[model samples]
Target: MNDKNDLERLRIQIRGAVQGVGFRPFVYRLATNLGMVGWIKNSAEGVWIEIEGTRSQLDLFLLKLEQEKPVHSLIQQLQASSLVPLDESDFEIYPSVSGEKTTIVLPDLATCSDCIRELFDPNNPRYRYPFINCTHCGPRFSIINALPYDRPNTSMNAFQMCDRCRTEYENPLDRRFHAQPIACPECGPRLEWWDHHGKRLASDEAALQAAIQAIQNGQIIAVKGLGGFHFMVDARNSDAISTLRQRKHRPDKPCAVMYPSLAAVQKDCELSDLEAQLLTASEAPIVLLRRKANISVLERVAPNNAYLGVLLPYTPLHHLLLSALNFPIVATSGNLSNEPICIDEREAIQRLSGIADAFLVHNRPIVRAVDDSIVRVIADREMILRRSRGYAPLPIALSKPVPTCLAVGGHLKNTIALTIDSNLFVSQHIGDLENQATLKAFKQAIDTFEQLYEVHPDLIACDDHPDYLSTQYAQHRSSKFPSSQIFPVQHHHAHIAACMAENGLEETVLGVAWDGTGYGLDGTIWGGEFFLANLTDFQRVGHFKPFRLPGGEKAIREPRRAAIAVLYELWGEAAFDRTDLTPVQAFNAQERDILQAMLQKELNTPWTSSAGRLFDAISALLNLVQISTFEGQAAMALEFALEHISTDEFYPSVIHQGIFDWSTMVEEIIADIEQKTSGAMVSAKFHNTMVEVILQFARQWKQKRVVLSGGCFQNRYFSDRTIARLQAEGFQPYWHRHIPPNDGGIAVGQAIIAASQLLKRGG
Candidate 1:
């Protein structure tokens, strides 16, 4: 008995990552089912909806829209207003309108359950289709070329849709209505196999079968995935694993092991509830888990590491390939030690031919190289070690909104961050920018994020260090965009601020940032630092005592140098006579005299209060590692040394005049070495000492909350124990979650601090 005049009309505007993720189709279905009349279309700004119906029906539609949004669509803001109702007849999806873009770009997602089922179903049209996807999952950042996300604006435009797919695309009733990446085996990219000689072996199903057989027969296969090529080998084959290690020149670094199912992962490693959930999450990432002692996985895969990095297949090709295999596979990035992962087929074959026996590639292009994200579960929380693949390009919701800004990250593990309105997007891991390839990748990441968001940045933030390439890049951009304000944040402070930003901490907290090196305000190198900080500023209240970084940056690769410095400070010239010293034994008399003079006169040696260097020094003293081949090899070796043992005892440490000293710890380690202390025992004691000394410092600070960040915290053995001890002391401690603890996360901190400054200045 409702009057026609009583019928309500409303116009709704929704923001966030609403496009290319089935938002419009969902709206169409809900409105049509509610017997309402409306026209829904995508705009660059967001989703716009006009609906006419009875008040009750209109009310139900709004509630359901909020409660049951599309799986991958994140609703940031929703607004509704009354509208004049004409005699609108039916619900329809209108053509996309290109307008000013202000919403979040949809991030790349793992395949959904429904789409996965469809991919494997023999009766389905997309059966065994390698590029199988729907609105709920698949490429977003990598494939997209522009906003108002449609197939024409994506790489999918290369393939014309067939009649059946066209019908689904045009019909609002279909599940894949307007699904941007929708494709079939006939209309989409096909898999092909090629030998190292560049001869084509097979195609389609035969190619996949060939790939399976190649991996089964202890051969390496470079398989192209959503982001890049994964050089895969049978994990159970120790010879295959060793061969891959030798070819890749990655001797001890752990590689990700891909299993077809949770059962397969469980067969080799113990999975906690959180770990299992993370492994099977929609944005599935590689999870680092403790290996079962008696597991049959090749020992060479992880070597001395206590944990194995494991992942379940996240793409259609992976699903199809693993379906034909029964063994876990070692899936490492297809590249040499320092280069970016291979994205192009030709590039992969050219670069990975020495490592890969055959190549399983596709015609579809990967617009960007996104590495698989790495994660570990600690203290019932998900800690992201490396953010990429499934979890990146998604905006981090800030505690307070700020103006559009960009933060160029630290030098070592560079990544860029852009904040448009309230959404903060941190780019994928853009490897060290010293090399031309990585620098190009860095530029591409920044440009890609800029183009994806259409953000005209109003502010810029970068590291304080003048020598860092990232800082220089920011300076160059600042000069290019003269109107944008530029701010430089201290490096270690940026680390702590990043921890604060991710944890939503607006109040002052005790931040203990431990890393390798950062340019301090006093023109010295600071890495092990304790600060009282909020978003705006920080005070250095406590820190590790300074030690000479002999030969400057060269000491980073030679932990023996750092050890020599510490030993010299402890026992003078007698430090060289220590019988257990490996570096002293190797050094000729002249070389030893020169090194001693350099330390004494401080020639080319800079001082560093770095916890990372301390770990390096300890590592060398223990004879675990003297010279590092990679950036973190020595420190990582130190972490792994005590992986098999548990200890509560700690070496002695002293704090005087707010300067924490590890001289006592160094001396005791030397004594332990002279007494032939076990490597595991010394390593355990060192880790425990660091944990104890930091807790003592936290007690001195008297802050109820503590924050830990920087590259040093990436060590699970260190972070886990530090977090545990802090919790025991009735103190709340915060660490990185969705972002890494290392320099990769510093951009978020820089951006946040800059934004806070802008807000404070009312900019």
Candidate 2:
């Protein structure tokens, strides 16, 4: 040691995601390994580090700290200053700062490999335990009540840790080191069983086994998960599936299946390399895999679809239950139709009383309700259909940080986003906030996100629809915070912005946004639209031709009515003269007369340029679906009917001045019907024509990037073929990756657009 003056004590202030994601333990390990004397503790501001060591050793420690941090941790700032040396003997980690107000919060993590191994290992103490988890895995965001990420700040505070768990939590070498939710079978939450009538069954392992037996016997069981409850039934039982459909009022929307393992999934569907990887990834999202030929799943599970939405068990509870069952289970959300998922046990019993035959209840309370995420493989890349569960609260990295803001999403598939500093926390899927229950859930989620992330928005952003609940909520909040700016973004523009943000594109591009309906700037229903847009600015350059919706909102529920409207637009009065139409035959004489008169008088009819309407028309034309039980049932059935068609020849409607010649398409479709073309062939031809039209537009704007978004892109046939054709033509085509292409992603897009607008205004 040359000089004693060289020895110094330095205090470092570290910030930016330096909490909750094993950052403290990482620091402890690093400091101990560096042979430096330091005491590190987490404060509300950030990690506080005081080190007294030789200058060279401190330099090496700093270098290693930057290079060797935890995989998920982000160190944004590291401030170091010299202090008087105390000559501490060893490095130690102090308890987290008490009662501190911290801005940083951690996301909930999927179960880690180490925990998974323990769950499966026969020799491990936690073998096959339904509640086994450690620091790197299990619940964080959902159980959390306040910041600093300690057990007392979570729902887990009610359960005192046993001595063994406390010892393991204190040991840095143990996987449970500092795990707030650490628990064992003896000390953690236990499962209980209940009948449909809210009467408690036997509270033992036999109860769980009996619950599994009931599911195998084709009974619907409501099982509580980490975030919410799920209704489970045997996948092979058609009667049970139909019963669930009728009870949930979800007749045609595909229900996801939970398989026991990946090996089981391989038997039912053809999984690609990426599909398999995504299935095995920590975020075990439901992967829409191509189904095997003649696989005998209940027809009601994926009515009229070639692919099945499948997911492997993500949680220990699911694993244990599925293993006991030894078969695929139809695991759909436990809720009434169009309602938010039930999280509280009392609420679940009250709401799902008539839907499920039994209940697999748990003692642990779920502070948040998160639905299972759904995804599909398009062009060899994973595309999110729904973003929830393992994905939410994990902030999507922005190209550039923005000021604090809150984004209230669209009327349907609603979710809210809050941006604080550099992190943006999105709420879980909030369903349609059109009803009282969903609206209440939306408000609760918003409050929870703000409290957890410690953010108060300086600006509020919402969809342009004045009547939407989300918009009204934003308006109310803005009125309360009079100084905060409020901005309304066009719905389709938000769709394109979401796509652009996901792909990290900055330049202007061609955006094709298609969906069911959105309140257009011109006050007409806009769905099929083409826009020239970037982050802030968007111009509508193209759209589908407008036609009268015979009964307005009634037409959406009845596809045959939309078909009659299309027929009237195409063949005029001669449409009723056709004797071969089954839809016409299905209508009684009085009903037919009323329909014709309504079309002629245009009573309560609204004009729409919606691609979703075209799908309804095709569905009714094929006689495949006359009345849609769900929102997009007719379109989904139409897509299913197209599975038999070849992609050899494409006949697309001409585009003039950026508008699709839908009148000509309708005439061509009528001609095909007159020629006695099979419904299957016509459906295939219609799908191919749409793909051709999209490709044509991409070729026209070859210089600009092509972004595919909106709920319509959820149709795999159109999205897959369109992407392939565009890539073949040597044009760059981008689709959604992390966020959903549907309205679920609209909140993030709204936030980005709002931030850009604020920057433009120099706010």
Q: Tell me the whole-model lDDT of each prediction, alpha carbons only.
A: 0.86, 0.82
Best by lDDT: 1
**Stretches > 4 Å off in candidate 2:** 1-19, 43-87, 98-107, 120-123, 582-586, 699-703
Per-residue C-alpha lDDT of model 2 across residues 609-643, encoded as one tens digit per residue: 88888888888878888888777888888887777
Top TM-score prediction, candidate number: 1
lDDT of 1 by residue, 299-321 (tens): 88877667899999988988887
Error of 2 at 619 (Å): 2.5
lDDT for model 2, please. Answer: 0.82
